[model samples]
Target: MAHPRQADLAGLIDALQAEGVEFIVVGGASAVLHGALAMTQDLDVVHRLTPENVARLATVLEGLDAFVREPAQRRLRPQAAHLSSGGQLNLLTSLGPLDLLGRLHDGRGYDELLAHSEVLTDGIHQVRVVDLPTLIEIKTTAGRAKDRIVVPMLLALLRERERH
Candidate 1:
């Protein structure tokens, strides 16, 4: 198997927006932007998976390369949408190895995605990103090792919020 590379940088997010493919910017990249997390090479995002959006994203990504799906296992994962380009990217999310890999966890949709989002601008294009507090909530709910770090930091921030 090949190592995963980062997907959806600011520039690419901008580009994806232009293409009209809806995605939410989440994980460490968004956390860094929100001043609650450090920099990250990988990018994670969640989208409202409807039959239409799924078909649209697949068509859009098909122009790039093949899309792959992995079987479900003992992991808090989501459906994934990946670019087949070997030198390019492999988007890993709660969404899984393919966008429509499995039903979304509790069928979380665009509204939930929007509820916890922060907007970021890269030049003229803007992207919606998941903010720190919500990211901590989402990641902690997922309960991954990397996400475990979000707990203490978030607790500190919450304490700080209360102190003020």
Candidate 2:
């Protein structure tokens, strides 16, 4: 079955876009795009969060009463399975549990997120999405128990890519 979450991801992108949080879909959803994994619950986005990005988001979320603040904790690794704040879903800065790609690219091993993202239709709106190569990076970086279930599928496709 096509991942149900894929459909909803557009909405999440719209929400963040409305909030002025410029982010790319870079987690599980990214994996799905690259055939590295399947559906997911929470939407994982990589925001630039540069001073300008932060300021823009502040203005957008402020109107909705939704707040954007630095997520507590510093270091983040894909290997972690749970959020420190106790929730399956959350927004992260530089924290683990989101399986955020360190660097991203379109084809090859991990690089930078920008390297492996593409734009997709987010409902009526268009949004950027992470490409497959980056999805593999996130999976490798995250290295979680669940990842074991996904790795085989990714490897099968990756090996095919290597052949040519």
Best TM-score among the predictions, by candidate number: 1
For every candidate in turn, the CA RMSD to the true structure comes to 7.6, 9.4
lDDT of each: 0.53, 0.50
Residue 78 shift from truth in candidate 2, angstroms: 22
Residues 1-164 of candidate 2: C-alpha lDDT, one tens digit per residue = 11121235545555557776666776666666555547675556555535565466445333333312234343222122222221223433211122222223232222245566777653566767766565566677778877667767777777887898
Q: Give the local distance difference test score of model 2.
A: 0.50
Tens digits of lDDT, candidate 1, 1-164: 23244443554454445567666776666666555655466555564555656555555444434333233233322223322111123433321222321212444545666776778664675678765577677767878787687667766765776699
Score candidate 1 by lDDT. 0.53
My TM-score estimates for the predictions, one after another, are 0.60, 0.55
Model 2, residue 112: distance off in Å is 4.2
